[model samples]
Target: MRSAPGEFEIIRDYFADAPIGEGVVLGVGDDCALLQPPAGALLATSVDTLVADRHFPASADPAAIAARALRVNLSDLAAMNAQPLWFTLALTLPHSDAAWLQKFADGLLQTAKAYGVSLVGGDTTCGPLSITIQVTGSSVKPLRRDGARIGDAVYVSGELGAAAAALPVVLGQKLAGEPDRDAAERAYYFPEPQLATAAAIGDIASSALDISDGLLADLGHICAASGVSADIDLHALPVAPLARQLAGERALELAASGGDDYQLCFTVPQEQVATLEKLGLDAVCIGTIVEGQGEVHAWLDGERWFPEAAGYEHF
Candidate 1:
């Protein structure tokens, strides 16, 4: 039998050939990657770690895990209206299985290439399975959480709650029809980073973020940063069909507070709302920013509504 691969062997055999995009002075195989940011543009960077059984199932396909890991980190750049550039991976594995490593690397590099990002450098070590990725990008006009103002309109891209509702199916805690299972897996493992949507609204949005911790919870971040509150029309939320199919009447609530959607939620000033409409983007007005101290109020049919939980908490 072939001996299990070592760290260097794994790196050489798997990740060294990642796409070398523009501005990468040096890529994988270096102790530290050398990157060049666009002239007069700011660098936007974010990192995330996904642990086995916490972030994903331990028995999940390695490729799917890798794809999800990179895509989620890329969502951060999209939130900042940044252009994808480079990334680094630090992977931990309990054992170095070549087949598993190949699948993981293929998924990682494919997603990276699709996003126009290059794998710069990373490390591999022996431990429980986990993936840590740091993505860096460039932004000329970065949207910030603190930019929202009272009277701004809140909007979200695509649909929501599908990923959250999909979780039960993904974890095998709930049995689903094959169609539902496929939809759940797609929602959970392949959330598209809203790069194009961000680009379309970057100049007009007052504040922006990707919804990873449900819409309400992530929107609260913008409210806190901008020192404003929001009043949402719960009936106006564009609930995902997957959520509706799986969660029944609770779909709306799941859409509001079940995390993992990775879609963009942004605020557009009343004046620029017309401009946003002219762009004809795939987003819908869900609420309005109001004068308050970071509270998010929801109303259903002119009556107050509440969610069962705030969102996913690390603790």
Candidate 2:
């Protein structure tokens, strides 16, 4: 038999004191989480969770945990070109440790402050040390994956595969003073969500999304969402030198099927190439969205490169 799911009684006694945001006439203690949407701007909301052994190591630094937990959610807001305004955190720690909470909260506040976001509310409880943050943002017109069109040039904001490369090291696999271990570990620990870059994309990019589930899989999302297919040049993929050092010639495999790279993969009209170039985003034209459907293709030196696996999948 399964254990009973957590109930509101448990939620209220522990987490009821957290402040509700602006215009929240009646807060979470009641029958529902009631709030009035902020004036003028459209609301954007996203929820993300980080599990101890799954998303990060149990031994991972608290500050890094706090930062990454927030960054990934912020990446979703960025994809919509929304300016994050506030967030609610729900933390489930194995046990209440004052020092750990202090460090984690401090990191959360610092990162939120840097992004001009406030912690409006949250819930805390006892569990297996998991963190879930729900964030809200404001936007004039939110970008959607449905807008991609044929002939649009697909671009990614930064290098990929560092986080995937770090997986082995996280599992206690020894490395020979390898720099990829450090780089990939950093990528996994402190994932830069490219919020500013994504925000700047604005109407320029017809479609956009953060690459959390590897390049090929996430690009497949855009294609499926927009009813299009993409032809990515495997050689054109911006493989970081550190990732190259780690995987050797199989670097493309890492970039293709390795997940956890939170880079923004987007499509822009060919006309906006110059504008995006001026942004100095370390952007690369990796592929083109075409009028088709189904799996995205990776062309390596004019031949197809099909990985034995697709990407990281929970369950």
Worst 10 residues of 2 by lDDT: 1-10
Native-to-model Cα distance after best TM-score fit, residue 42 in candidate 1, in Å: 0.4
Residues 172-239 of candidate 2: C-alpha lDDT, one tens digit per residue? 67766655455666777778777788778885889888888888998898899999999999888887
Candidate 2: lDDT of 215?
Answer: 89
What local lDDT does model 2 show for residue 202?
88
Per-candidate TM-score against the hidden true structure: 0.96, 0.86
* lDDT by candidate, in order shown: 0.91, 0.78
Highest TM-score against the true fold, candidate? 1
Q: Where does model 2 exceed 4 Å of error? A: 1-38, 180-182
lDDT of 1 by residue, 1-315 (tens): 343332344566687668899998976654567887889999999999999999999999888999999999999999999999898888888988988989998998889889899888787888899999999999998999999999999999999999988999899884545547888899999999999999999899999999999899999999999999999999889999999998888799999999999999999999999999999899999999999999999899999888999888899
User: Candidate 2 has which clashing residue pairs, if any?
Assistant: none
